[model samples]
Target: MAGLRRGRRPDEQPPEVRMTTLPTGAELLRYVVLVTGVIIAPGADLALVLTSAVRGGRQGGLATTMGIVSGVFVWAALAGAGLAGVLVASATGYLMLRLAGAAYLLFLGIKFLAQSRSVAPPVDRTGGAGKARSFWSYFRRGWVADVMNPKMAVFYLAVLSNFLHPGDFLPGKVFFLALVHASIGLLWFSSISLAVGRSNILARNPRVRRMLNLAGGAVLVLLSIEVALPMQW
Candidate 1:
């Protein structure tokens, strides 16, 4: 009777509490370094920035960078909401997006190839006629190129998934990460644009411009193929 009185009933047990862990400063630093390397790596994003810089000058390149950064935030928000994971998990969704991205990249590559054959000036020759229009054009191009890239979604799903904790405030952390990535991109692309824009040789040489267009176009097509291929992950 005394032992029975001392024992607690099953219904009287305490509820289990889940603990959330935030990323440590060291972890954050590591993430920043990793992200910076990725941003600076040779990819569609960097190629787009270089092309824009060569064609539209510093203002155009910066505008394009802004657009690309905006796309990053959009991706981060989607990832934070768990939408990116859903897309990645669903075979149909992943396939659809992958195909779309591949098609877009192919189109861009073809356009570049066509431009290489043209006799137009290396830079936009519209001058004051459609300055505002040109800026918006480059901005839209950047935004579309970044947004249509399924690789970004995969990156967030695969890479950030490891860095972020399920119990943590996901949206806040993702936004912070996105902002940091964008800041790095802006800094790097801005410098490239300034340097490219100041180069009279690149701006004046039609042959070099043609070669760049051909190279960029080829790289995009290759990237598209890479995207279209099935991954084991």
Candidate 2:
């Protein structure tokens, strides 16, 4: 047996395993469409963007979108590194994250509801003098809202995993996919911001503004409840 093995040529040795093929053009297109649809769907992210746009105009909305995208990038990195698996595996960790996220969402909803009942329209306190500071404030709010939500981590771990091919270059592929997702979010939110920002009629109408605030607040509260409850998805 040893003599026979030694006699075998190198070409007769087992072939090296190959990496999975990259997604084809059709697959890429399908991914883009699916991701875009998900971004445009109504959710906490959309509600936040709409509220920010109406209150702070285009810059505020854009800043918020940037914050959200930053959170997505972090999630992608964690998922690619397989660190997100830890969160999924640890019941205690997942529960803590979920509770924190729910509390934050509840706080936001209550604040919005309170504002809706106020006599004055929501004012941008930064005015013309503190544009930079105002931008950062909105950015932080957006980032916190996204990062606190354990669902985002789960989404990356669950959904993004399907797109990743088995290979040594998995991290690169995940990051690239995340970039695409972020790009779609930016474009969608920018359009919403621009549209809402330019609508002076909607902005000036106290009744309309109040209704929007109430709707947004209610939606947020419902989302929080959903997060708090155990659901199989």
Best by lDDT: 2
For residues 15-120, could you state the per-residue lDDT of candidate 1 as single tens digits?
5555444467987888889888888899888877776776677777887888888889888889888898999899999899988888877787777778778646
Evaluate model 1: give its TM-score. 0.83
Residue range 32-136, candidate 2, lDDT tens digits = 987887788888889888777756678878888888888888888889888888997899999989988888888887877877786466566666668888889
TM-score of 2: 0.86
lDDT of 1: 0.80
Candidate 1 — worst ten consecutive residues by lDDT sum? Answer: 14-23
Indicate the worst ten consecutive residues by lDDT in candidate 2.
15-24
| 146: Cα error in model 2, Å | 1.2
